[model samples]
Target: MEWDWNFVRQIMPVLVQGVKITILATLLGSILAAAVGLVIALGRRSDNRIVARSIGLIAEFIRGTPLLVQLYFIFYVLPDVGILLPPLLAGVIGLGVHYGTYTAEVYRAGIDNVPRGQWEAAKACNLSSRQTWTRIILPQAIPPMIPALANYFIGMFKETPLLSAITVLELMNQAKIVANSYYRYLEPITLVGAFFLAISLIAVVLMRWLEQRYGRIEP
Candidate 1:
């Protein structure tokens, strides 16, 4: 069949809405993931052996599980226990948590790269732990991790289509809706791919800029 501009025009608005939802899910999910990952990373480094080991095990378990399974459990299983969450919120949590485990490692690597001498110097200066981390460790640690974190954010963006399984209506879901309604799979599906490719290429370009800006840490 010939490409029809008329049909594309009809579907553009809905698809754009889907694109917005996709970006929203990624942004919110990345924010949650960054917080959770930092906590998990810090917890794994706690002075207490039991706490450290427990947190490490939990991070490994979550990282081992598939993202889709985590999403299903969050969106569907949790409601049975009366802890219901809105679809988008649930999706972001699921994405955050699952990817958070991975980002935790990124955090750990960055943190570990900070020289032991830096820690000693901070203590020598009589800097409180809070001042040490807030002023010294984190600022240095976080910059190098930005590229990896940004990569995961892009990965999460690509994975937004999985949120559709829970009825989140991201780009893929919207594309499916348009195609199903009109019985023309080609245009909508193709446009979805176009959107994903266009955005991902843009994200990669940004990621490169971030990598250059952040440089690298020696772990």
Candidate 2:
């Protein structure tokens, strides 16, 4: 089919809505994933072997399973057990949890990279564990981790298309609907690609800036 500017214009508004939702899901999921990853990392590093082992096992299970299956479980299976989340909420939870396992390793690495002397000095100063983490260790560890975490968020943004499996009206789902309605796949699909490519390029530029700012840590 010939490229139709008119059809493109007609579909822009719908696709724009989808784009907003796609971005929203990614942002929320990224926040949740960051928090969940930190928690998992800390839990796995606990002094108690049982807590560490349990958290390690859970993280490994999550990392081992496919994200799509997790989404299916959150959106489909949970409804049977009396939990029914909205599609967007379910998708956000699924994305956060599935990626959190991977990000936990990033957190662990960043934490480990902190000089052992820092911990020793904190204890020497009689700093509480909370004060040590907040005032010293985390402030140093988190900066370097930002670039890696941003990379995961970018991956999460790209994976937003998976949200469509749960009926979330993200870009890919909107494109599919438009294509099915007009019996024209080329325009909608192509538009979807263009939107994704454009956003991904923008994200790459931001990621580069983040890397320049926080890619390194001094011992």
Whose lDDT is greatest here?
2
Clashes of each: 0, 0
Residue 67 C-alpha lDDT in model 2: 93
The local distance difference test score of model 1 is: 0.92
User: Which residue pairs clash within candidate 2?
Assistant: none
lDDT per model vs. reference:
0.92, 0.93
lDDT of 2: 0.93
Cα lDDT tens digits, model 1, 61-152, are 88888889989999999999999999999999999998888889889999999899999999999999999999999998999999999998
Q: Put down candidate 2 lDDT per residue, 8-108, tens digits, no spaces.
A: 99999999999999999999999999999999999998999999999999999999999999999999999999999999999999999988998899999
